[model samples]
Target: MEENAIRNKYQELGVEGFYTQYGADYSNPHEAQIRQLLLQNQDRIDYNKVLDFCCGSGEVSRTLIEAGYGHVFASDPFTYEAYQKNCGRECWQYTFEDVIRTPIPEQFSAVICSFAMHLCPDEQLFPLVYQLFQSTSQLVIITPHKRPELEQLEGVQLAFEDFCLTAKGKQVRLKAYTSTFTY
Candidate 1:
């Protein structure tokens, strides 16, 4: 979906029910892998405010908050209320067009986005990456599909696979990457 079309749709239709669709604790599956990756790179991340960009339903944010991490935020075009009720942290809901129109919030210690990067429009990908880089020095991106383009960026320091558990007791392989780019 194009940026404007999604924004228009959300404006007219309102945010959809989340629990009935994506469930509440949907972030658990990726927890172990995320923890492992963080632990492996603890020396780099400054443990400052973390933003889970494209955090659908705020599962990741809720998990982090529950784990006692402070200063965490989430952002997505929809799922604002779900994130509020589930994570209890502040979140910004912005469409691609909205992001393009307005500048992303300033600096973050780390920006973690899981399972949603592939949904980004082709034209918006570069800008989104640039935005992320500008907003944070540490970037963690996990996508279910291949995004070789991200590897070509200037300062992606790490790339690995994260096996996220599925509802069916299976594991879904996701491409996990870390971009330690400043600016």
Candidate 2:
């Protein structure tokens, strides 16, 4: 799906329904690996204001809060009210395009996005990455390390050391990589 198309589809997804469908807490193999990577780099992340870009169901933001992050803003194209209600934090139903159109209210000390970047093609993803780099002091991107992933939402279901394929096609292996930078 194209960026504009994805934006439109998610915009119609109401908060209550979004969670019932794609809530973050759902058992995903990659979840533990992602958490470990974040934990290992705790010193690098800012414990202050954080933004979970494309925070599907607020699971990462919720985890960060529990890990002592002061405040977290969970934003996604689909507004999952269940996450806000159950996670006890603010949730914004904003598309990635919206974030680009309008700057975030407060600068984020640490920005985390998981299983979201792959939704855009490289043409958009690289620029989007640059944009993310500008919005926050630190950034964490968790996506499958494959070309196709740059344009689709299909993520690898991680197991121990490898990410299993979620979509049917030439199976691609995901090697978790955590690239961090401080500005």
Q: Please report the candidate that would top TM-score against the real structure.
A: 1
Pairs that collide, model 2: 15-79
TM-score, per-candidate, Cα-based: 0.66, 0.62
Model 1 lDDT, residue 182, Cα:
50
Please write out the lDDT profile of model 1 over residues 1-183, one tens digit for every residue: 433554475456643433234433334345555554444544555556888887776755655666667788788766666677776767787665666666576678877777566656677876777667777766676543465357665665555544554445544444445666554
| Local accuracy of candidate 2 as per-residue lDDT tens digits, 52-168 | 877765657766877877687888655456567667777777666666666566677767777666565456654465456567655556654454332232222211223334334
Which window of ten consecutive residues has the lowest lDDT sum in model 1? 17-26
Compared with the true structure, the alpha-carbon lDDT of candidate 1 equals 0.61
lDDT of each: 0.61, 0.57
lDDT of 2 at 41: 59
